[model samples]
Target: MSGKQDCKTRYPLLLAHGLGVTEHGGLYVPWGRVPDVLRAHGAEVCFGGQDAWGSIETGAAQLAEAVRKIRHLYGCERVNIIAHSKGGLEARHLISAMGYGKYVASLTMLSTPNRGSRVAELLLHARPGVAVWARGNDAWWRQGGDKHPDALRAGEQLTPAYLEIFNRTHPDACCVYYQSWGARLGKHNTDAAMRLTHGLFYPAHGDSDGLVTPQSARWGRYRGTLTGVSHQQLVDAQGVDSGGFDVRGFYVRLVQELVQMGF
Candidate 1:
């Protein structure tokens, strides 16, 4: 039964990546082997295909299109979304603000800054050169295939103040089921790649996955945090298990639960 097709859902699953990433390129997958594993378990997996640095609104627009395309291609009425980090915000915007609520069966978010990120606020409010830095990011991403990337605006939208307004404006749709998961680094040295971010995020927020805190990551159902995992590790960016946390298996179980839920 372990090798059986057990993770299939009523609606297809769409994997939405976080900020500063493409879904997959070459042998690299921001979601690691999760997509393939889900497919192997009888799940029809798809990608949100949003821009790496686009604002939530723009990302939502892209997701809206992706949902429509997926619905048409798969001949399904709705999809179950598994969004990471900022992608969660985009998914929320699509379902609530973009009038795609009826098209989404459920939303499962990972390490999303639902309330907002103090780290983002700290970075954005750093200096007068923030605008220049944002422009530089946009330029780089544009060169990398993002048509109208707005790094500054996108970063602003991640701040607590902006998210406060955002949460008020984009309330959860009654038609959609929403759930979220967070991650944590355990200690400052849990993941060397996340060391700096963990250092920066830990003082202000108690438990975090380098970038997003547990509090900020909680929204809707609030499934709790994945202990001993970094923001990157949560998405399997490094593609290896860490401290007993099997990122791939975690996603498999997640989808399996979705299956049980009749999504």
Candidate 2:
């Protein structure tokens, strides 16, 4: 908490994981490797906490609290946010809705669904029972019902409501950066099944990181894309492509970019 305080020095890195999942889930995936690698490279990594099934607003509030705590503990006003999946949406909420942009230096999302997913709609309809169960257990459920007018209005369209708020609030703050990556299953394995399930629920455009597609992941300005990395592989330290590419290194690079940005 008391390391680098200079504005030019590396800033503490806050990692936000996507919805219906925990930080450990990210850690369990290939993308999770980013935190360890970033820490090895002198990044102060913190995970955003909120119920895995929580709404974007709820997750953003949690992230806002985490940011305040990070700033209080580190004595740094600005921190870099490296979010994956729903975590990206939560980070955007923190900056745009919770007013954490004042404390945010940069934001990088990994396989986030900035655009609405047809798969999500299908799941909402196809698996009403699952949706009810998820909603019941989800933190967002505590706030309001799934059919709540606000909830209905927020993510009604392709961009979703929370994402629109994020775009309006953050609107490319100084030194703010955005980038994304995607993955697909090559064979019918456990990982591939997971990707298929995610696809069924998220229904992204073209290629995806299993759940969210590269196109769905776009928000703010575009940076570029990384192909052949599955959603789970993106954070898994043990995950390796047949081509021998280090999937975790991709996230590490993203973290490094945030650190270089003074966040």
TM-score, one value per model: 0.95, 0.75
The top-ranked prediction according to lDDT is 1
Q: Supply the global lDDT for candidate 1.
A: 0.86
What's the C-alpha lDDT at position 200 in model 1? 69
Q: lDDT tens string, model 1, 10-39?
A: 999998888888875421358987777888
The Cα local distance difference test for each model comes to 0.86, 0.60
Q: What is the lDDT of residue 261 in candidate 1?
A: 88
User: What lDDT tens digits, residue by residue, belong to model 2 across residues 46-132?
Assistant: 877655555677778878888889999999877877777767877776776666777887787777777655555554454557545
lDDT of 1 at 181: 88
**Candidate 1 deviant stretches above 4 angstroms:** 1-3, 25-29, 188-190
Per-candidate clashes, comma-separated: 0, 18
What is candidate 1's TM-score against the reference?
0.95
